[model samples]
Target chain A: MSRLSGTGLTLAYDKRVIAEQLSVEIPDGSFTVIIGPNACGKSTLLRALSRLLKPAAGTVLLDGGDVHSLPTRTVARTLGLLPQSSTAPDGITVAELVARGRYPHQGLLRRWSERDEQVVTESMAATGVGDLADRNVDELSGGQRQRVWIAMALAQQTPLLLLDEPTTYLDIAHQIEVLDLCAELHERQGRTLVAVLHDLNHAARYATHLIAMRDGKVARSGPPGEVLTAALVEEVFGLPCRVIDDPETGTPLVVPAARRKTSVQAEV
Target chain B: MSKVMVIRPRAVVIGAGALLAMTAVAVLTLGTGDFPIAPADVVKTLAGQGNAAQTFIINELRLPRVVTAILVGMALAAGGAVFQSITRNPLGSPDILGITSGAGAAALAVVILGGSSTALSLAAITGGIGTALLIQLIGGRRGLQGYRFILIGVGMTAILNGIMGWLLTKGVQMENARALLWLAGSFDGRGWEEALPLLGVLIVTIPILAVVCGPGLRMLEMGDDVAAGLGVPVKRLRNGALLVASLVVACAAAAAGPVNFVALIAPNIARRVTRAPGPNLLPSMAIGALLTVAADWLAMHSGYPLPVGVVTGGLGGAYLVWLLISERKAGRI
Candidate 1:
């Protein structure tokens, strides 16, 4: 297990500036949800923090050491990422697909040990895709397939997991199921997670801490109730919203007021 | 011997078995040439018990062609498997990048210029690797899209083919009938001189690819973005794979005069047989070796003698069609 902290991250894509002079301390062992409308740099922030994108200025420090300076396999051993829409080799079984995650751990002479097997088996079991271990990954339904992919990321056995839109392709039921699995993994493994989620309510319910982004800047960030207010949602999402409390989780719930017809706005 | 012969698949097991049977045919071919040795005498000669005449004929005449076919076959199949997986295009081969045409054209130049046989082989190998490198350069750094790579390769093939056709028109060059057949891609008249170089090259090259390309091949399969994210140097891996594939093609083409179709078929056959998604190298090499030997044997011993290339090209073309039809039938296309 490992913990990551420290930042002074200024990230940009080529010449198009995104985040500038950004710094934040991510506390260890917490579920952090980054939520914003598309193109607000939420995903870009995650990419920078995970060392997938180099900061134009500043550094991302993992456990008091520079993340980029660390050996790739060592960083991989500590942190795992499930990028949005990863393509697996077609026709590969779920078990074989999961087996690939052990690549960083296994070297030429030290390949495929019992520990690798146990990790993959336990991951498939923990992610609730144990039965799908033998099934062709491509043949399973969207939600089942997503879990299989999570099992692959889990098999890395990293203490920190980052997911970019894990619920992108799933239906409502499947989205909840996928997030529920993420929540379950967080609870069982005591791993810190940072995910870029599209659904605000889901983010509020699942995230212990929430960061809202607007136009490549952190608009607000704190406990979900404080950050996801009606005024903040309207300002960040350009949507008028009413806030309510969830009966199940006691998280702030956002209800969109209504689609504003341009003609009605003109009348107003 | 362990009784537990792990059954991989019927097609793979039987396919390899058929290839071994083809090796016998190649040996039989050796003994049947002029100054022929009888089958029993060949066995005796191999065992160091035959008469002098039997020993000379068996040792001198037959072994080279058989060995040549086996080595070239293994090389082509290995090349095919790597090419297909790295490109993630099942239809891909190093030949698709026009390395074969470059080798053939170089060989053609040497033969027409009356260069020694060794010079022709050397030229073919040099030409093949050079052409493969050129293509990789064009597709290097910021990688070329799959369709763009294929387009460039097709253009390269067309240019090399034109060069070959143009060179032949330069003089009143009267080619021997055997030479003409060889140009069409044959293993007919080849002997030990040809097989030896191919075998030496394969012994060095195949194991290198197996070891070095093992990790890089997986990186290639994961697509460049993810592979790079995983700390693989993408362009470097790409270059390494393409280089190995080109060398394999060059050695095979130089030895066997560009035996057609096996590089295109072996990997697919191996993949289908194993039911594994990524390219299965060992199986591909086995299938490639089997296909070439079987095609060569069938060509020599069929209803009448034909160049091995003609048989391979014809069979390979039909296999392509059958594959297309089957995929279409299964709605996989």
Candidate 2:
């Protein structure tokens, strides 16, 4: 069974509705990817699932209990979240940044434990930031900084994880490094993942289940092979496309239609 | 595991060590008066068994002064750190929020109207808290973005200063001299009568500082959305910090008259020394005490009888310039 499910969910900012009558179930241990154009409510839906945003009409349930009513630490213990960017205090080391993920577990009289250290170390190693632990987070490269954030999320030691636009602003190599790490986390660590992604190719390649959203609605939901058709891409994105199987992995590939700027005489 | 456990304990250990150093330096702070005492005799006086003349010099006179310095320092710095955390600004302090301005005017009113000392303290506390509230109302919910609160506070401070200046000019010489009692911030001429009242506030406020402000501060630093998402009651935390900060400044100012900049510089320095976001409160208290004691020593013994506020106020302005230049260099401001 999936750990997080939003039912009959309607989300909006103030009075402007972003997603209406929305419903989704993020499967346990499954890499689920949400892909859509900008302003398509993908991030909003993710926030609703993560309990960061309140749904206007319905509730997000965690294992059959309302997430809002459950203690924040309880939800945090079960589900970890990595926002697009995290702010760190000045001169804060990567290790310290990661250690903050253990805050929900700490208290006034309680002390740090070997288990916390182990979790923090393993998270850093898993995210390939083990060597960068002592370095200041703000001084690191964008890619390295992102890894430090992931290490923080991993340090949370949650069974389910949600990420919003985790690949934004990265070059091709760094993008793959991030996605590949996410893939490793899903494949090896068996952590449930729900990510909002812009790159459909990356989404199809990594996602076990894909949900393509459009104009405040889920346009299609299924395995990538059947749901991610050229027709569906054109309808959802308002762009024409050609679909083909990926050479590296057998998943739908989307190529958008383009217009020639010049006719034959103009080109001449 | 060992490292993590070790660092927290070390912060406390080093904090206590700083406290001890401050106490020893405080001993030097004594004997700064016209008649000096031997260090051993000062210690003997401190232990409550010394010769009569030394006892009168140290216990009857200097001891209360030292305690006053410690109380003012702790009150201002600890209050500043809490306010800065909740507001998420390096510049936030009780004085910057117009608390001191209100206290000054209120204390002036008490003296001009011949209010009792206890009534005077009450009036000052109420006035200080009210002024802080007034600034927050004018500045609104976006406290730090445009320096609106600070600018508004400077205006309030100027108004209060004008009122104090006018009141001083209006009085007869003897009345003016009595009014002047509140003007120069001093540990001079104080006794346990002054220290005792402050002790009550310290006992009530310090535990509240430990239990309430510490955790809520961490949440406040990450912005409202993130803090609220983390389940910190953001509004409550902010308002509580403001309330506590107001009370602290008012009580300290009532006890010692205003001592400037210990609040501003102490927390900033403590944060740097600890390498943490908000100043570690305990260390900040220790540092504040050191700063006040140091300033008092300079005030009493620096070849002239300067008010401690003059030294500290000058220090605060220079620090402001330094912070501005450094921030401009770093491209943060």
Candidate 3:
């Protein structure tokens, strides 16, 4: 499997520096989730790693070569990214949308082939969107639409997939549904999955490799059991919380500590 | 869980059907003029074997006008489709982008300032390109997203219209009247001098457009970030589409004097008719051709002999209003 890593990277947008001298390696065949507070540069780091945002310094390497120096379509054939939000074109069917992911593999003379058809079919089946293949994307519910989007990413047939805040606008149930799908894709297929997630507890529950970020730096990086703790949660999020085992999964679950009233405030 | 990727049959049918309709419309319109000739004679003369009167009517009088309508329809519709798909807004057409108005302003200036047909064509093309480049420089850094680009385009259009109004009022009566007829988009005196150059530009543009529409436009509908991730050279694709669209609009406006609403309405009409998922470039072009030819026929045959632009503007404005109401009802706005 090709290894993906970024070393000694300086990430920036225009003039404002987001992260300086940041280095990280994504472990092979693991569900790696990066968690951070709002504007902590988690998404920025993901963007750099995915080659959506070029680093101000250092290199993003796929295998041994510099990713930026590689042919963009070649890099795309290896790594696929699902952005947070993408609007469906009017009246587009799920199959047609997913078929677009085959673009990187297609050449000018070689348009859609039989293999493209098979891959698209397999991707829809894998994402459990086969039944919705003929349905217009706008008619589907939010969770279904997200799945269709993921199916499109899967249709790219890349081994390494990165998602930036895949569960952002989704409600609790839908969030869990998407995470469950991601976990299944990782564990079943042995593909490297990197996602930037907002909820710490959800990240701990789903991610095999957890990266906790604070102030443009990785505060903790390890397995969920080793890295997630009450003290770390308090330090990272500035919220006093107790970390306990999840009843169903035995992963770390954070419970916020209740605020106590002082004597003067209580009297008033 | 068995599913297959399939091409849309409806779109193919619609495309072929529109082409057939355009052929019929073109032939019919070619035959309906001051000295009316039969459709048989129109085709016979087009094939370079006809009587002297038939040859004169087809070759000298009606052929260029028909050819101009066809080319303008093609350019504006295809250009509109490109703009709409890139901007991801149904209302995002060359007319909305201030391109047509800019061309109109330049063409008017050329008319008043005393220029040849070729000079006027060249100036109009430059003006459209200038306006498009200005829009790109100002609000296009982020790509054509949200209201900013459209708003800026509207402002520019207003300013250009203001300039055009000033030019018309300050100019002499004969020139002003001639400018007004041009602004209303007449095919009354258009000839091979205009049609030949536009055909040359189209010969280059249409193939490039066909090549890009598949991957470039398909990726674009997925949004810029996803498009980039899919290995589409996003900036290059966008710039290419913009250039092609701008050039076509310039060429069409130069030929037909900024005929209103065909660019704005044809792409949307094609989409609705074909029910295609992505950008309907070919279908839109066909629809544009048909709409323009049909409108020209109506304008000439309307007893008072109105300009083609008047008919298109009136019909297209009504269509726009209907679209607004429908979109609002569907909660798209």
Residues B1-333, candidate 2: write the lDDT tens digits.
332232455557667876887888799888667788877778888898988888888887888889988888888888887766665556777777668878878887788877788877888888888887887777756544346666777788888888888877777777667667566676777678878878788788877876666765665565554444444555666777778778888888888777787777887877777776544788888888888888888888778778888888888879978977986898766
**Candidate 1's residue-wise lDDT over B130-223, tens digit each?**
9988877786544643666767887888999899888777534465343456566777657888887777877887776776667656655756
User: lDDT tens digits, residues A99-121, model 3?
Assistant: 88898999788888888989998
TM-score-superior candidate, 2 or 3 = 3
User: Candidate 3: which docking quality band?
Assistant: medium
Angstrom error of the Cα, residue B190, model 2: value is 3.6
Docking category of candidate 2: acceptable
Instruction: Superpose all Cα atoms of candidate 1 onto the true structure and report the RMSD in Å to 1 decimal.
Output: 3.9
TM-score of chain A of 1: 0.94
Please list the residue runs of candidate 2 whose C-alpha ends up more than 4 Å from where it truly belongs after superposition.
A8-21, A262-268, B1-17, B105-113, B131-184, B219-235, B302-304
Question: Which candidate wins on lDDT?
Answer: 3
DockQ of each: 0.33, 0.27, 0.64
At residue B120, give the lDDT of candidate 2: 78
Measured with DockQ on alpha carbons, how good is candidate 3?
0.64
Worst ten-residue run, lDDT, model 3 chain B? B1-10
CA displacement after TM-score superposition, residue B78 of candidate 1 (Å)? 0.2
For the record, the alpha-carbon RMSD of candidate 2 to the native fold, in angstroms, is 3.4
